[model samples]
Target: MSKYLPLSERLARETGDQWRPTLAEIEAVLGFPLPKAAQQAAWWGGASDKPHHRAWLDHGWRARDLDRAAGTVTFHRDPTAGQPPPPAEAPPVIEAHRGVGGMALIGAGVAVIAGVGLLAARLMKGRKA
Candidate 1:
């Protein structure tokens, strides 16, 4: 439902590996004027998450070489397109405390609580004496 869907279709139809469409040309395809942000080179970067970027990226194109002065953006066919991404390595396993160490920690905590209780009882008894 992106407004730039037409641009996606247009780029999909392009036979060349590279396309340098003018801002005006892109706007024409979108049936609207480009936003003020589009004047910046960063706006045409290869950020696939962006709607405009997705227009090209979904069609196996990646925007680069933005010429703001000339009001043009060069989109090259993504070489990695249709290829599977490299497999991510499994994360390192962290061993949890599973023996006496863990039990000792719990035991120490209980001993501290018991010691505090005994101290409180002794203080109370001395006050009552």
Candidate 2:
């Protein structure tokens, strides 16, 4: 899609708070014309859950000083939120039962080895007798 989501994200990261690049500057970052929705100012707002907004919001940016008549928009980064933390998920739980299973496998191997040794010793005794 021509949402320019990736391009918007790059611009937000590349520009500092004082830096306000014009539409042309943004297009240079994009390397192409603004996307269908990107061309409109309303699409630049962060309040909406529009897919394009996430491209900037995820990177700590929100639209500001947008001059539609002049074809310019400035992106301001969130100082407090320099980076958004990853979404919350269940923490990995480690259990003490793991080592018990491994020990069981080791014990089985030792038993087999002992049984084989006993059988070999019995065979040797029978052969000698």
Candidate 3:
């Protein structure tokens, strides 16, 4: 087995879409310190032939971001790599007549009806007088 197999297993166990592993964290996972060449960004790049690259790629992860200064690499899960696509966001439910607005509309309708009824009552009273 490849020496990087431990790293692959660790990444495979992660359920998040992205992982930011520091160089030290990666070293711990691999059970050894990274080589001097690992300081370079190209060393963390995607090269299917590279054992280290294959360690993550084979598990549906890709090195998308690297921070050489911070000594960190960010791996993103490959959606098309036999992994289920993220659930699509459901459309928002819009109720034109709901909540306080609906209540206000009903209250206004009642007020208008009551006002008309009072006006009719006054007219009838005047006729009776």
Candidate 4:
């Protein structure tokens, strides 16, 4: 089954294309990652039969409602009353630093300790001699 339904018969009449956005497109527009379960629900049809298609439609409605509430973009729904509020904006992205600063500090500390130990050993040997 297709991940998205064809534009509603009414909408198709108004809009030129039967174009419907996929689950991935919706997530992209929202600029966030959805939970695995929600993603599954949204694309369930991408792998299976008619029920998955139906599930995608049902969950897609909820997701679209959330996107609208977050003010990411405007969307219209048929009959309109069942719409939910927009979802919250996506959280900021995290970046990991790959610099060796931490490792370098540890290496410097180890070297200092080793030098102190060697100096102490040499002084003790000199005293014994």
Candidate 5:
């Protein structure tokens, strides 16, 4: 059996999906396209046995460790540096309609109050004249 048999079988059985690459199958599933150097590092045994990928293991290079695992290869960062942090999440967007509706309601209220006050003032002034 190929070294990737277990990973291929697991991916097929769990996700009902098949990926043909002999190496880096897990990375493909995770949507992280590994660089050529990373792939080679993983192929040479620098990652973990798990399906997940990490840039380091035991605070050291794990490229060689990953090479020994069956199924798909994993990539690891060199011992000198840790993996970069995950990308920042975008803030949720607020729709404009709600804000516009609030502003419209306030404007309408002010207009009605001003109209009523003007009518009351005119009536009082006409009575006095």
Candidate 6:
């Protein structure tokens, strides 16, 4: 079967928006019966994982609103390939800085408290009162 078809491109151009093509029509353009994969719904899922989707996908057409019971698939020109996510509004960044002087002051304060605690402990241990 022909891997690609001119009809797909022509249809995308002429239809300009939505084109519902029957399976028979697709096969006719392809010049052969579609492979078994075509019968699978995923074949028209607009995902690029399968080779069968390439025929229409290459022409920038994507499947939409697939109706399995009705045996119909709507193809739409998806040049955007789905639009990109809207730009995120990031939270403003906050910078915190502790200078060497600030750290040293904290350390000194801890040491003074420890010294006082030790002195008090020693005095209480030595005295009856």
**Per-residue lDDT of candidate 1, residues 1-129 (tens digit):** 998899999998999999998989998999999999988878887455788887887778878888878889898998674344699998865567447687999999999999999999999999999
Cα lDDT tens digits, model 4, 27-83, are 564455534554433432233234423433343321233232233322333332233
Q: What overall lDDT goes with each candidate model?
A: 0.85, 0.71, 0.86, 0.44, 0.49, 0.70
TM-score of candidate 3 versus the correct structure, residues matched by position? 0.59
Pick the TM-score winner. 1
Estimate, for each residue in 80-114, the C-alpha lDDT of model 3 and write its tens digit.
54344489998886776448787899999999999
Write down the RMSD of all candidates, one decimal each. Answer: 3.7, 10.3, 14.6, 13.7, 14.1, 9.8
TM-scores across all candidates? 0.73, 0.46, 0.59, 0.26, 0.27, 0.50
Residue 116 CA displacement from its true place in model 2, Å: 88
TM-score of predicted structure 1 = 0.73
lDDT of 5 by residue, 12-76 (tens): 34332222334555555445554465445444443354333322232333333334245454334
Instruction: Give the least accurate 10-residue stretch of model 6, judged by summed lDDT.
Output: 1-10
TM-score of 4: 0.26
lDDT at 83, model 3: 45
User: Taking the candidates one at a time, how many backbone clashes does each contain?
Assistant: 0, 0, 0, 4, 12, 0
lDDT of 6 by residue, 31-76 (tens): 7776676666676774564555665666777777767677666888
Clashes by residue pair, model 1: none
Better of 2 and 5 by lDDT: 2
Which 10-residue window of candidate 4 scores lowest in summed lDDT? 60-69
Error of 1 at 45 (Å): 2.2
State the local distance difference test value for candidate 6: 0.70
Ranking by lDDT: 3, 1, 2, 6, 5, 4
Error of 6 at 33 (Å): 0.8
Candidates 2 and 4, the one with greater lDDT:
2
